[model samples]
Target: MAGEVPAAAAAASATLLALELAWSPSTLTDADIEVLVVQGLLLEKAISGWRSYFGEASPSEDWTATVVFRSFYEKGFGLPSGAFFWGLLHYYGLEATHLKPNSITQIATFIHLCKGFLGIAPHFNLWRALYHLRAYPSKGTPDVVGGAAFSLHRGGKYPEAIFKDSNKRWAEEWFVVANPTPGLLPRTGLPPVVNARWEEKPTEEEMVEVQVLLAELQKHKAEKLTGATVALSFAKWLTQPI
Candidate 1:
C-alpha cells in the first residue's frame, strides 16, 4: 500500500505537469519537458511526505506562501516583476482595477498564476501600490516601475498585430531576438536595456505584504481542508467574473 501510494502520486504529478506544459507560453524541447516532469515528481513526493508527517498540524498558510514567494525570488532569472506583471495583465485581460487587496482569494489566485504560469516572482507590495489597492493611486503603469529585462518595441517595429496573429511563435521569436548575442538581430533591433537583476532580494515590505495576504486567505477558509482544496477553491474563484 505504501509503495503504491508513491507510484500513484508520481503518476498524478506527471499528468499535471504534462497538462500545464501544453498551455506554457514558451515552447519546450523534449529534454526540458522530461527534466520538468522529474522535478515535479520529486517536489510532489517531498511535499506529500512532509504533509503526512505533520498530519493535522501542517504549516500555516502564511509560512507556505512566504517560502514559495521567497524561493521564486531567489531562483527566478528570466523576466523581471514588472514585465511579468504586464504580460499577466495583457494575457488575462485584467486591468489594475480588478486587483483588490481585500479580494483575498482572487489575489492569491493571481499570485499563483504569476509564479506558476508566468514563471516570475510576484512583487506583492509593488503591485498593490501600483494598482492603488490600499490608497496608493488610481492609475499606474508597469513601465514606471523599471527593472524590466526587455520592453515591447514601439511604432511599427514588432507591431501588436504581428504578435496578436502569431500565437506562441511570437514568444519563441522574442526569446531568440532577445538573446544578447544573436547571430543576426531582427530589424527592430535588441531590447534597449537588459537590467537582469539576478541577485535582487525581496524587501521587508514585500515579505510583510505576503504575510498579510496569506493571513487573509487563512481567515477566508471555512474549514480545515488540505492545501489542495484551498488551491482548488482559488482556481474556481478565478473562473468567476470579477
Candidate 2:
C-alpha cells in the first residue's frame, strides 16, 4: 500500500509539471524578435535574384542552378541548410541569443517567432518540430463555456523520446561544423556525438553576400521593409567586414 501511494504521488507530480510547462509563456524578448526580423530580411534579399535566374521558367530543369533554386524554395526562407541558418545567426552576432538546436521548446519558440513576427511560410524544420513534439491543432468546442477559437496540444512523451533514441541522427541534424562550406557535407546520416556545438561561422563568400545585403539595406534605408526596424543599423555595424 505504501508503494502504491508513493507511485501515485509521483505520477501526480509529473502531471502537474507537464501542465506548468505547457501553460508557460514564450521566453523570446523584444531583442530576439528584432534579430529574427533582420535575419529573415537579409536572407530574403540574398536569394532575391534566384527566381529570375533559376526559377520554374529556367530553360533546363536538369541544370544545377535550377535544382539549387528548387531546393531552397522547398526548404523555406532562412533555411537553405542548417549550416546556412547557423551561419546567418553567427554573422548577425546572434550566436549567444539564438535558440539551442537540441532544445524542443526553443525550436518551437523559434517557429512561432518566424510565423508571428516574420509572417513567412513554415519550413521542414517546423514540420519536424511538430512531429517530434507530437503536436496537433485543436479546434475548441463551439458555444461552450470557456471555449476558445483554437489551440495546440503538444504531445508530452515525444520530446523526451527524441533524446533517448539510439540513433541520435535527428538531433545531429540540428547542428553542423563551425566553419562549413555549402555542398561539402551531406545533410543527413552524420555520426552521432555526445556533445555538439551549435555555433557556425560564415564562409568568405557568405560574408561577402552579407556585406552586399547590408549595403543594399543602407541604400534603401528610406524605404520600409516588412518586419524590419532601426535595429538593423546595429546589425550592419556588427557585421561590417574587417
Candidate 3:
C-alpha cells in the first residue's frame, strides 16, 4: 500500500506538470518547490502539537491539523508537483515524510514564475488599467486633470480628425521630450521652471495624495472580481459603449 501510494502521486504530479506546460510555459520555479517541501515538513509538526495534548493518539475531532495539511497540499499542487505526497498522506490519514525534491518540477516551476514575474503571462489588471485610463480620462478623476478624452466609438477612425487644427501643435525641434505622462501629448510651449523645494525627495503631502489616489482606485476595483477571464472581459469592455 505504501509503495502504491508514492507511485500514484508521482503519476498525478507528472500529469499536472504536463498540463501546466502545455497551457503556459511559465508557472513554477525550483526555489519555490523547495520551499513547499520545507513547508510540508513543518505542516507535519502541527500534528505533534495536538498529540502532546491528548497523549500518543491525536483526537479524531481535532480539525486544526487537517486544515494545515490542506494548506500544504494546496501549496504543493500550486507549484505543479500535484502535491502527490500530500495527497497520499491525506488518503491514508497519516503524517509521512515529504517526497524528495525532483529537478523536473523545480525547473518547470521556475520557468513559470519567471514568465509571470516578467509579465509574459497574460496580466489582465495591467491591461485593464491602461484601457480604462485611455478610454475615460475625465470620468472618475480629479477636476484639475486635463488630457484627450476623445470618443473612440467610431470604428476604424482616428479619435482626432486628421485635418482638425484647432489644438496648438508643437514642433519636435523646439524641445526634447523626457519622461512625460503616458498617453498625453507634450505641451506646445517651453516647459515652465519652478523654484527648487527644500527637500530632494517628494514631500509628505505628495505621498498622502498618492495614497489617496491609490485608495480610490482600489475602491473602484473592489466591485470587480479578479478571477474573471481576462480575454473575455476585455472583449466585452472593448465593445461596450464608453
**lDDT on C-alpha atoms for all candidate structures:** 0.30, 0.29, 0.26
Error of 2 at 79 (Å): 17
- The lDDT of model 1 is 0.30
Candidate 1 residue lDDT tens string, 147-197: 122122222111021111212232221111111221111221111121222
Better of 1 and 2 by lDDT: 1
Give the C-alpha miss distance for residue 130 in model 2, angstroms.
Answer: 26
**Each prediction's number of clashing residue pairs:** 0, 0, 6
Off by over 4 Å in 2: 1-21, 24-201, 222-242
* TM-score per model over all chains: 0.21, 0.20, 0.15
Model 3 Cα RMSD, 1 decimal: 28.0
Please list all clashing residue pairs in model 2, or write none if there are none. Answer: none
In candidate 1, the residue pairs with backbone N, CA or C atoms under 3 Å apart (3 or more residues apart, or in different chains) clash, namely none
RMSD of each: 23.1, 20.6, 28.0
lDDT of 3 at 123: 25
